[model samples]
Target: MTPTDTRALVAIDLGAESCRVSLLRWLPTGPQCTLVHRFLNNAVETENGLRWKIDAIEAGLMEGLHRCAAIATEGVRSIAVDGWAVDYARLDDDGKAMEDPYCYRDVRNITSEESVHAIIPAAQMRVLTAIGIMRINTLYQLYADKLAGRPQAPWLNLPEYILERLGGRRVSEYTNATHTQLIDMHTGTWATGIFERLELDPEMAAPLVLPGSIVGKVTGELATLPAFADTQLVAPCCHDTASAIAGIPDAADDWAYISSGTWSLVGTLLQEAINTQPAREENLTNFGGAGGRILFHKNVNGMWLLRGCLDVWRAAGKDWSFDELLPLAEAQHTPHHLLDVDDPDLLLPGDMPNRINRQLLERGFGEISTKPEDAPAMTALILHSLAARYAQVLGAIADITGKKLKKLYIVGGGSRNALLNRLTAQATGLEVVVGASESSTLGNFAVQMAAVESSADAETIAEWAGVLRTAF
Candidate 1:
């Protein structure tokens, strides 16, 4: 078999709503990306709690890899995986997952979060980890496992677990690890003090590695195939949000980004960590970014609000598509009462329309009708509320970081919402630049290309990102 037959790269993006597999091949003219496969993904309520269908996820990804081998006749060069952060799989002694990973949205976190704070105050956790204090963070999730008397074993975040399953080493990528709220922001390692205080085992955590580090090559049955024999597994910014941000080719230093999807992360990149009292009080996070930069952002509720409402409408036989709803929403007048987009009640799944109305009634505002015909009005209210929240978060980021933000680049599936973009631009008074919806896939491939060709340093990744942007 010829080793240099092809320079094709594969990128697997695991998302809350859907999982996608994409391929990037170097052509005579430039790089080209193809969507090999995509499938729906959602958490399910199990006897234990809300859990991911990881076995099904693994099977679907394997199918996509086989398809890639068939089409990229020249042979596959490398592979990478990026996805949503905060969820992880605990492994047994035999190096197999004990069970499907828990979904971060489970209600069990509420008690676990309180228990953790009682041991180590929320203020102290922010000071140590520099991450936003959220009940959904992995720190609380792990403690929840302990509180339930689960057996102790090593755990890997979802993305890293996939890489390990593909013959890579067990290690947590920095970008994703920061989301766990267990890393010391100043030292860039696990906060042993917090673990000791909470009595959680520090040894159970995987060693951390930075993005662009290659864990291993393809092994096992697939390695016998010509296309997979020499494939290297690279851990790109394992957090989908970080990869999406890296995919942006913008050169301006004065601009900020919104990785808008299930969650809208609103913030700018910073050279250093900001763990000041005011910054912590604002509930801003300092997630690790590509090239050792800090993704100083706040998590604002995004399309999840609209998605939840859609679920209720679909169950009632409304089944309205975004294509049909966006125009209708755009035509409607501005909503008189905007939602508190970050309301905790709106974060859970099911009956979103009712939950939204309940908040409105309690706040002395008229509720949006949940009738099928009035769906457009609900859409408008959700969009307007999201835009207003984005503006508020961006303003806080600017004040904390002291950066004059000129452009607001919106990436991910949410970028396709023209009405929301227009509202965001109007509310924030910034030049709204719409970025690629598949930014995570693009960023995944860009980092792989940079790592294989030269170095996956900040400069190299940025250059590759610019080159790939032209393909779209």
Candidate 2:
């Protein structure tokens, strides 16, 4: 692809199982981003909690930046990092990371959510902040830490912390801030009221900045590097879901989006946050989106169930690639059993096979397959269950928001699942559009381009994104 006319900007998207770093070369006609590097990301079960291998991710990020520095024709202009939310890195008095951030699936929230909900009823909590109730949310994680007798560390959320570590200022992007449940959706500030009820200090939460704001520039040891001199840091809907939504090329308001990935986030963008009781009852979250929009969606257990089940089978010596199993699983005619994928029991850790089997039995789906060959059917059943659940969430979103959904754009790693995508289309009965495998990074670049452009608007960003897509 011919490179674009404008200067290059890099975006780093940190994910649960992987980290991606890309460079967007903006042209007068449009833009194009080349992924310079990608690396495996893993969370370790630490003595304190389930935490990210933060240093490794940093090393990987730097290596990617170094690659960007190497290939840049004209000097690169800026860099930014965005990742999944709720996980944060504790910092010392001098701002060094005291410890790695905890993974959202760390299972530490065994008892903390109830405690927070006791004082703030689920419905009131929604009215207070317009945050949908969910078990793995940041509020629950924070309460879990306190209940475990751990003191609050002078911590920074991942997005702010990454920029700070790169010698940028400290501030959480508004989109990511909304996930913490510590931010009041109404005031666009930290929810001191919620923190007080939980008896936790609220000052440690990061400040908010709009998407596309220049956070700072690369400094520290890497500052001397050739590529670091002109590198600017920008926050673009740093939350994975928010960035994914921003990357949608279509501008039609009637279209919904399913950020199909480890978590299936299904929703439509709204200018106003829907804090009504029905929205709360449906557990529909209204997170901050790019261009000051709200992402009205629900988090469905996405590819994680499949990934976890495969992990268990792989441990038993049945090496299976997703591609290898897709056809076999797809051929499994009628589902022998289906799961209520949203069941809280499915969210925890254990022998996922046993757990799924137990669930099937509990639901009166009868006995499950015991042989290794039975896995394809079981996996298909899981996917079918997911599609069924997606239908429920899609309808729920429309019902709560009163918005007519024209289409659903699926993005991210799991968006590549053709089998599941087709099923999702059939279930929702809405036109399905498969979008960027690197949507979050694209959104990051789109926001940066918008920030740098003279007249930035959501429509403008989406238009630029359509042009930038030639890189794919």
Candidate 3:
């Protein structure tokens, strides 16, 4: 396949709150992208703990693929999947999941994080991995499984697991693998020293592959469809944040990005890793980006806070949508008390309103009422807190990277939040450029297009990204 081929392409974005399947078709005029399907995705509490229903997620994706097959008479040429990182599925000997993957938010990771730090201090871990030492990271999650004495088995992160399920070989895309915090910062391979120190089996990890590498041709029932007959499964920045960043058309070095969704990743792209003592001290991460760049950033708590609060309100009969709440939140005066948006207690689910109020009370500020009517106040507080946090992180990024950021590109679901965008611009004092709400989808398709056209090198990705942004 090449640039001249007119076959349509498919990009599957598996998000924390929702999953979408997008289709890209090339026509004489230009490229056209259509959102063929989107479905709600949530972790459910079970006898064990919070776990994703991989079966349901797989079904939803398949349904979308069928829709794409039905609509794209040009025939789908290739497919790729990008998603939130960290959480993974343990696989049995036959490559089948042992059970649903544990949600990164599962409380078990708290103990696991403590245990890992006990053996290999957090500072050392950060210097070794050059990744943010967060409890939700794959290292802690896997350590949790080990502490529970769960059977040892090979594992794959969510997006790559989806690709393997679609008949791709078991391999971790480099961008997603770095999020595990088990990869050597310098070597770009599994950190054997960390594995030895933690007593983990290094072989359990899949071999690392660069983005745009074709894993396999589509197989299984879906492959039987005419549109999928020759579809290749390409790994395109399997970490959704990486793909979202790739979707940006601007090639300027004076811009940072916030892949705003369930979590907001605030950072700028760099030519190399920054694993110095100062970088480790700030808890900033250096994730792998498309074209082998470093995604120097900090993970700030994002929409999850508002979503958790909304969940509590909905159960209490408030059921306010963002559309109904944002205006009210904007109409209200700035919150007198700002939250430490990355508060540990706010990371978990359940009773968000109380958790927020508890933080307020602890800080000696008056608590916001949980009444349905006062939800906007809470919403405003969350947005304000997030914006303030973003500004702080961006400041740190500038100081560490020496990049004078002039623009902040907001992408993902939160890009649609005008209120948050305005607040971020005001707080960060940078010109805010609102990118696509489905930027991950655009990046996914862009990579697929690049892979098929020639190669997914830096120049190729940028060219395709520009083309897609224009068409979008």
Of candidate 1, the 10-residue stretch with the lowest lDDT total is 1-10
Query: What lDDT tens digits, residue by residue, belong to model 3 across residues 140-159?
Result: 99899899998779999999
Q: Is candidate 1 or candidate 3 better by lDDT?
A: 3
Residue-level lDDT tens digits of model 2 in 1-472: 2323356888889888889989876555556578889999978877877788888988998899888888876767777778898888778888877767778877767567778878888778888888877777888887887887777876677877888988888787888889988778888888898888888888777677888888788888777877667777777778988887778877778888888777888788998988877787788888998888889888888888888888888888897888899999898896855788988888876577778888888887776674566789878888999998999999988887787887888888888899999988998999888999888887777777777663346776787567666756
lDDT of 3: 0.91
TM-score, cand. 3 vs. native: 0.98
lDDT of 1 at 23: 89
| TM-score, per-candidate, Cα-based | 0.98, 0.95, 0.98
Among all windows of ten consecutive residues in candidate 2, which has the lowest summed lDDT? 1-10
**Model 2 alpha-carbon drift over 4 Å, by segment:** 1-5, 26-30
Cα lDDT listed for each candidate: 0.90, 0.81, 0.91
Report the candidate with higher TM-score, 2 versus 3: 3
Lowest lDDT sum, 10 consecutive residues, model 3, at 1-10
